[model samples]
Target: MLDILIKQVKVLDGTGNPGFIADVGVVKGKIQEVGFITRKAKLVIDGNGLCVSPGFIDPHAHDEGCPFFDEAVLNKLSQGVTTDISGNCGQSLAPVSERYWKENQSVHALINPPECMHEFTSFGKFLDAVEKKKIGVNMGFLVGHAALRIAVMGLENREPSLAELEQMKVYLRESLEQGALGLSAGLLYPPGSIAKQDEFVELCKVIKEKNAIFTIHIRDEGDYVIESVKEAIEIAKRSGAFVNISHHKAIGKKNWGKVNTTLKMIEEANQDGLNVGFDQYPYNANCTYLNTILPPSYLVREREQLVMNLRESQFRERVKEDILACREKWDNFVVNVGFAGMLVIKADKTPDAVGKTVSEYANALQKDPFDTALDLLVDNHLDVIAVYFSMSDDDVETVMKNPYGMVGTDGIYMKNKEKTHPRVSASFPRVLGRYVREKKVLQLEEAIRKMTSLPAQRLHLKNKGLIKEDFDADLVVFNANTIMDNADFIVDSYAPNTGIRYVIVAGEVALKDNLYTHAASGQVIRRKEF
Candidate 1:
């Protein structure tokens, strides 16, 4: 007897193998049988004309706080993502300290964790709360280096003292003991920006000891991308921890095609006995805080102080000079992509600014584009989301073709938002539709492997990424011929994709006929003993 059964589905078993016709049986939340199943079941699906593969695993996700608002995280589930490796880019919702809450509350808000999370002081407590919410997809998290720094020392721009460093290590070790998958460093953002290489190496030592992974959003993705890649590799070498680069891309026009060099570097490192890999979104553009256009010094300041600095004439001139100079000290988004390339997607105080480029908005206001961007940030409490059209399509394809590469959404979601990166709701299907099916950039099986087994191997989830008997029953069924991503940059960015027919999590049907079943069958995937 089976709890649920599917008959005559074409199975792509997440191993980069050709598809085969088979029947799959599920019982007790695990895959019970495959290949010509003759079983009785409570629920049966005629899987004809559909391909069933292991449910996609999002290797790099930013959904750590999304469950607080929408426990189902329907946007991701709708895309066939059964598991999310969140707490990437050095931001998590837990291990909150009174100092962090008091001084760095705005920074904390960037991850969008609920205010009540501040009351809990440990990563385990936060995970417990999320589990209690009965989320719709399994979630694994990494202890965020920035959160750790803020917890011990609030937004300080210098290296930690030895005692302070040990405290961070203690917090990290405790989090790992309590089920954190690993540690993630957003070196592109502060206090992660302030951290020196030694800080990462020391923290990664803890990660290595715990048999966990280290994921980093490197310091620079523009002019200094090669150096940043080297930096990540060196950290892995020093700490002997597996390092995964988050949302890997080469931004800016002149910096296009740098991924070729970086990918070679990653391969060389791996060949030399260093574990290094990367996750990438399919799009050429990237999204982040609007204030990233300013220098790193301004980013570390409090919201009010940053707004005051922006308002001052002398400070504004100096800031303009720095951005215009295109100094390589940090990633200067404005100089790289230009105001026309930066579009405001979310500006709560200035709704008119949403969906308009900084240049376009500036023209309408008869103001300098830089000033207009500054005003939006100020008007919105320094929390504006913008998408930058910076990468090359060629580079996007090149990275996609890499054998060591995997897929990630790097999707930023806001509750009750009218717009977001299409990757939030369409990454998996877009890969299948545009890249695999339309462009033939990758074979269907290989793309599924990247989304499934490869990331599962990285996260060390032994059971979730394959379709073998006795594995967890997380699967996706879709029509290969009609699968396509409809989400676009200008219109209906949040529209659900087509061709995803059924999504099952832990033997429970969470999505059927492209609609959510509102099932809460997902579990909190903790660190496993290797």
Candidate 2:
């Protein structure tokens, strides 16, 4: 007898194919059968008028520490995401050297608070902790370049010494052996920003040797975006590792349609036999550290020193000058999008600044916008979250239409009443409702394919992307007609999406009737040798 059975559901199958009426049977933790199944089971779901497809796979996620702290991973499970590829954007919580742990604590705090920092000292230990925690969503991770660098070099701006480089390679190889899917670099952030292309090529050699992938949040997303894409392609070509671009976009008004050129470049690279693709969240705005508006020159300093610099009149003017000058040295968010486009979503110390744009907050305080932003950073100990409205609708659609494009939430989780970008909760549903159903930008099957099979295939998760016999029984049952994202920029950022009827992970009903079942059926998806 089957453990669970769904009757008369329209199975989309996760391929770019039209849905068909069928019954699916699940036994143990795998799909037992698909077709006209007359299996008897303990729990049977009448999937009439519901569309069942392979559970969504988030190709780029930042929920590495969610399993340890919140095992349910409600934000992901509620959106029908059964699997998350965490450790994206060069941030993972593991493999910390005891010596550098204190200095690197601030970085890890972005994922987990200080109290939880001692839980994992190595990549293997982190994975083990997640496994023991028994999360509600399957998770795979890429070893972060920043974590590796900090472990060995402690936020040094200079290139690694030969011995230090070897040590990083050792950590990366050990991480792969212990189950990391690949290496991810956030070149836009430091210490990743400090490293050069040569350094990445060397690290990717280790990735290639292990048959793993290399994913990157490139060095720039505005003005220099084309150059950044070229740099990623160069890394892929030189290292022979599969490269996936994280949250690909052309930010700023002037760079609105640059994706046309960048996509063509990626396609040409693929045609030349280089392995490359990109993932994008279905939103125009992006969320990140408020200080990213400042140039990288300002970011390399320690938090206290940075705050000191922000408080200094001379240094503050220089920083503001650099931002307003639109220097090509880094992606200048302030100059590209202007103060009006930078919205403060989270600032614990400056509660009044929350829900206000930098410009608005500055006006209320009767101060300059740059000073208001700098003061917020100083008051908040250099920890603040802001949303930048910087991408074009046409560019977003263009990337989505590409055959190589896949979906990722790039979602940042917030605690208590802290606000986050709506993409964290509304990405997948928004894509289905607004783009696929309402705007007719893509068919349901194609959109589902991008969300499911494409990402799984890219990450080489052989058993999880498709609805086939003997595959992992991770599934989602949703009302296509009623599905829509309710979360928005200002009013509601954490509101759960609508029409996600059921979410099954590892053959267990983790979410039923639009409510999380709190089932801890998820497992760690470690890397397997090709």
Q: Mind giving the per-residue lDDT tens digits that candidate 1 earns over 1-530?
A: 89989899999999999999999999999999998988799999898999999999998888888888888888789999999888999888768897676554567676677878777589889888888887898888888888889999998778899999999999999999888999998987888888999999999999989888899999999989999999999999999999999888999999998999999999999999999999999999999988888878668876688887787889888888888886645778887899999988888899999889999999999999988988888788887899999999999999999999999999887788568888888999999999999999999999999999999998889798899999999999999998888887778787878998899999899998778898889889988777
lDDT of 2 by residue, 381-457 (tens): 98898999999999889898999999889998776525889888789999999999998888999999999999888
Instruction: Name the TM-score of candidate 1.
Output: 0.98
lDDT of 1 at 277: 94
Q: How far in Å is the alpha carbon of 127 misplaced in model 2?
A: 0.8
Q: Which portions of model 2 show Cα errors greater than 4 Å? A: 113-116
Candidate 2 clashes between residue pairs 3 or more apart in a chain or in different chains: none
How high is each candidate's TM-score? 0.98, 0.98
